[model samples]
Target: MEFFKGDKIYNFMGKRLPFLGFSTILVVTSIVLLLTKGVNFGIDFAGGTLVQVKYEKAAPIDKIRDILNKTKEYKNSSITKFGSDDEIIIRVTTSTNSVSSDLSDEIRNVLKGTGNFEIRRVDIVGPKVGGELREKGLMAFVLSLIVIMIYVSFRFEWRFALASILALVHDVTIALGAVSLFGIEVNLDILAAVLTLLGYSLNDTIIVFDRIREGVQTSKESDLSKVVNESVSRTLSRTTLTSLTTFFVVATLYFFGGEIINGFAFTLLVGIIVGTYSSIFIAASFLVQLKFSIEDFRTKEVEKIKKQKEKEKMRAMFEQGTV
Candidate 1:
């Protein structure tokens, strides 16, 4: 089913500047926030201990925090309810070089007075390991962009690749900024979500780029901007459907997936919205600004025709000589 009529045309290029300017402002604000406020790194990135416990009965989160607060050592611990009211996860960062076993024992003892609870698991990360993980996570993100740029450049053109990279960066920065601005903890799971968004955003972009490439090859329109605008309009229905369907799925996860997957789902939700916007506005707008001309395609077609004519003339000459 088509959301838009078959012959409908929207002047996306006409409003290119506004779209681009809005994206630019978003990206710049995100960068400024990232530089100044920074992300709230979770236990995985910041050296810490994570303890998951399940109580026999429903436990009030505030009481748990109160129990931990009795001990000065555990006063600053972060407590979050997991899948249910009986389940909770607590994280604490300590400068003390206590072993995981010791830390686990300390945590258990501190909460022993609260209620009968079972320790599901405990994880510990040292400062050295956390620093390594932080570095690698960043490297992974940067490398994904580099790889995407190379692949798009090979599949389409350098201009297309650059534009796509910028869009992907835009999607990621805005997603991360939203996370930070709202004080969502950044962890390995969130990092994975960001990487997934890179691919998701690129897929949408490639679809639009493919249509633009086809339009340039087939359309007789001399105005490259018109060709781009037409190309985006043609794919509007498909882009909207894909984004909406994906958003529904991610929104479900965000609401129902529990605390473990909350960040992941939220990241996907933000990425999908931003990614869809960039494909239509940021990517196509860049093509127009870059002066992507249909002349390049036409010139190549003309050369192919000239070569074919030369071969045909040579064949005729040979046939005449034989005669």
Candidate 2:
């Protein structure tokens, strides 16, 4: 089924500049926010204790914070409501000598008289381990990009590879920026989400690229712009259907997945939207700017013909000289 009807053509390439500008603004804003405000790194990467507590009744976050602050040891603690008002998550940096069990007990004791609560879970990460996790997370992201570039280069061409990589970067940057902007906690799970997004965006981009490749080989259109535009139009339905279904699922998870997986789902939600936009506008439009044409794909055949003609000319020259 087609999302767009009739034989009408949409000029997706024509408006690439504006779309690129918009993306540039988003990426820059994200970078600036990342530098200034920074990501709210969770216990997984920030070396801390995370305590999840569920109260019998809804509790005021400010009161909980006030109660924790009364104890000098817990004065610097950060308290936030988790999935619901009745659930609270408390985070505190781990002391050099404190054990995870001790930290949980201390937190429980501090808030004991304030409300009837149960400790659902406690997680601890030491400074050394958190540092390692942070470094590994960054490495994972970089390696994924390198692998994706290599795959795209082999599957298509260098220009397509570069375009796809740039588009992926754009999608990732925008997603991270959204995370930073909204003060979402960045953790291992969120990193996994970003990687998942990388794959999703790549899949969408490859579909468009594959269609464009086919159009170049089979379509009568000579203009690269026309070919790209037609290819995108033809694949519009598939792209829309895939993105919509994925978006719906991620949105559902975001709203109801609880605090544990909220970051993961949120990343996917942003990435899917940005990824779809980049595949349709940024990736294919970049090919037109690079002067990509059918000739580029037929370079080997053209070179062979040139060599054959040169050989014939040399043979003719030798025969004439001998005559």
What does candidate 2's lDDT look like per residue over 245-281, in tens digits? 9999999998988778888998899999999998888
Q: Clashes per prediction? A: 0, 0
Task: Compute the lDDT of residue 272 as modeled in candidate 2.
Answer: 95
Question: Which TM-score value belongs to model 1?
Answer: 0.88
lDDT, candidates in the order shown: 0.87, 0.87
Give me the runs in candidate 1 sitting further than 4 Å from their true place: 56-75, 81-87, 99-105, 301-323
Look at candidate 1 and give me any clashing residue pairs: none
The CA lDDT at 119 in model 1 is 89
Report the CA-based lDDT of candidate 2 relative to the real structure.
Answer: 0.87
